[model samples]
Target chain A: MSNNNYVKNLIESGMRIDNRKFDEFREIEIKTNIIDRAEGSSIIKIGNTQIIVGVKLSVGEPFPDTPDEGILIVNAEFSPAASPSFEAGPPDENAIELARVVDRAIRESHCIDLKKLCIVPKEKVWNINIDIQVIDFDGNLIDAACMGTVAALKTTKIPKYENDEVDYEHREGELPLVDLPIYVTIYKIGDKLFVDPTKEEEEAADARISIATIQDGKICAIQKGGTGYFTISEIERAIEMSIIIGENLRNLFKH
Target chain B: MKEKEKLIINRKRLDGRDLYEMRKIEIQINPIKNSMGSAMFKFGKTWAIAATHGPRAAYPKWQQNPEFSILKTRYMMLPFSTWERSKPGISRRSIEISKVVNDALSNVIFLEDYPKTMIDVFIDIIEADASTRCAALNAASIALALAGVPLKDIVSSCSVGKIDGEIVLDIAGFEDNYGEVDCAVAMIPHEEKVLLLQMDGIVTKEEFKKMIMLAKEGCLKVYESQKTAIKQAFTNIIDIE
Candidate 1:
């Protein structure tokens, strides 16, 4: 039997290959301040999937449109170390999509107080760059990457800037974060919908949707991926699951 | 922003459209004779042309599948499409859009019939005023059908947004730049299911649901227009014969 059929058969019978509930997530581990050179850094492991995220702050001129707000850039690299499919060149479509989805979650949630990062309106502002590196290949990279990024951002500190120069050694204030946005991705396999699929389950998914929600249960960003279709009821169920799972994930930051 | 002008004044948008009104849409079939199928779709100021090429044998050999054909789509915006000349090359944004558009149309096309083949869809935006992806998909769907490609259902798409505390439909022009939230949706009307969905910006859960419904209504309207254009094209061909 093919992997798709085997996975589908298992899911149809309310069984996942990893033997977890449909909405259950694998064990997650997060460690912060792992990189001394970066302003902030974290490594997150969700099941077998491991990702390292680093946050860097630099002074630069703002974009022409939103000059008064600080800039937030997200980039993701799927290193060859993580999987045999990955290459050592520029980012691929999946990497680009991963970065953009995480970017939308952060930007749309209004989590970071961008205006507060502005040093000189329209002229100079602090640019926050979040770089996500995949160290292990597994399923649910989107959720893992988002969690790694948020944890890294939470630990980021602003470096001291004086006399048109940045003094990296004298870091002072923390990143102006007012809210936390948690991302949840649900995969639809056959007639069932589940969260946190393993790598094998991901290969069998017919469709998937990633949603980002804030503390108030307000949706900030959504991306429906894959070639399969979904009914309205399925979409609604996905939203409900995301909100419930997002709340649980947010509690991880209470410490 | 306190002193900034409102996007909607007395329920009228900047382009004289109401809260749920869509801009005028026009579609022309087989605009490029050299290709297997081609179409031009316009939504007010935004224009997209799509060309469908062969179920030709897949190149590089390794990319071909023994069981089914592969579908590839490329979406590009001309340098002069925007106010500021966009750089002439593929950007990450275009790459992502292409992938989504490909996926949106993938299930609808009957790829199993053509083994070891590839169907290529090229969409170019000659003009842009937001919602370019929706317009491009509309054109591609029609072009594929005209090219003798079998499809289960036609795909239609539209976008809705939140601006000035009100959910509105068919967001265009300056509304995209100033809107608080934007949601684009594509649907297969016959199947009664959504094929594509994407959103950015902020909105309450209630408003998000409203946006999806409103965008669906807008897509149905586009579907009506597509039906008329396709019928007219066939009628023209019959008259010629």
Candidate 2:
């Protein structure tokens, strides 16, 4: 059977290959502070797919427009070793998109108190680098990456600095984290919406909408991907699903 | 860490495991359907997954050998697998590990049976505490067997090393970093053939002999798990026709 048939059969029969109900997400495993050298790091596994998110801190000049605020840079690398389909090269479109969606969740939500990161207004500020890597591509990378990033940044530590120089060996304090951003993605297949599609389901999905919500179920970011169209009713239902499902994921992932 | 207690105290290593104890080993085959064969191999906190594809015609055509099939392998650790986030990609370290793993499998596989074809194995690390290369080799062996690839025997591998002046079996991640020596051994237990043998750090001749013996014992235990894993996967896979 073709990929389409495989998915259709499952939908017709109910549940996924792993026997998960259509609306249910895969089992998630999160481990934070796995990287000692980096200020913060997390490894998240959604079913078989896994992603590593690390936060690196450095001193730099803040953007002119945001002179007193800290900077957040999100970078993603899809390793060829993650899957046969991935190539050895710079970040591809998929990687760039993964980073952007995750970045939007934290940035747009103003999860971090950036102004406190400024050492001197317009002169020096903390440049926070978030690097995400898809180490296993079993699917559902976006949700996992977002969780990893949020968890990592939550645990980030700012290095101690004195006399205008950072002491790389000593950590002074934790980053000023104010809110938690959670992402929930729902994939559409043959009119049905599902949470956390496996790689095969993902390949056959028509379209997917990702919603990022902070505390109190407020939507902060929305991204729609894939070539398929979504009905107005479907979008509404998905947003509802995002809030309900995103809450559960966030609670379970709490540090 | 105290000098004596950091590694070994009363012959028990960190995590309170005996010097001869191996990590808890678990294997799940065919976790993903896209590949011909796949396995999720877990050795305690160190976890890895391997997938095998091919015996298909070699790509680019020119890479095919008329008399034997080519085996391609890639090994990578997740950035969060270690204390520090490692850069993801095929680094010099991974390349070397992949090459050696390929070499270890070459002798056990009946590559000559499938001429003008290629078999690709990819290993992805989820969490690594140490001896990932050996774990990859063991996982790849199960994946190949699950894919119905012809094998002389399923290969089993393990690492032995010296910590606190005693040779130990199945070194964990931290022991690998702080230990004095590491010797990885891969074998076909029934035939008792050493397909791969590599080591690093300083060792005396007597210690080398002892390490190899301990490694062989560890490999045998791993071989039993590989056989049972492949058998279990097939038992659930009933014939359709």
Best by TM-score: 1
Model 2: residues >4 Å from true position, as ranges? B1-241
Tens-digit lDDT string for candidate 2 (A150-210): 8898888999978888787799799999888888888887778888988888888866777
Clashing pairs in 1: none
What's the lDDT for candidate 1?
A: 0.90
Local accuracy of candidate 1 as per-residue lDDT tens digits, B1-241: 2466789998899889999998988888798888898888888889999999988999878999998889999999999999999998788899999999999999899999999999999999999999999999999998898888999888999988998889999889699888898888899754558889999888877787788888878888888888777777744321110
Candidate 2 Cα deviation (angstroms), residue B144: 49
**Among these predicted structures, which one has the highest DockQ?**
1
Poorly placed runs, candidate 1 (over 4 Å): B234-241
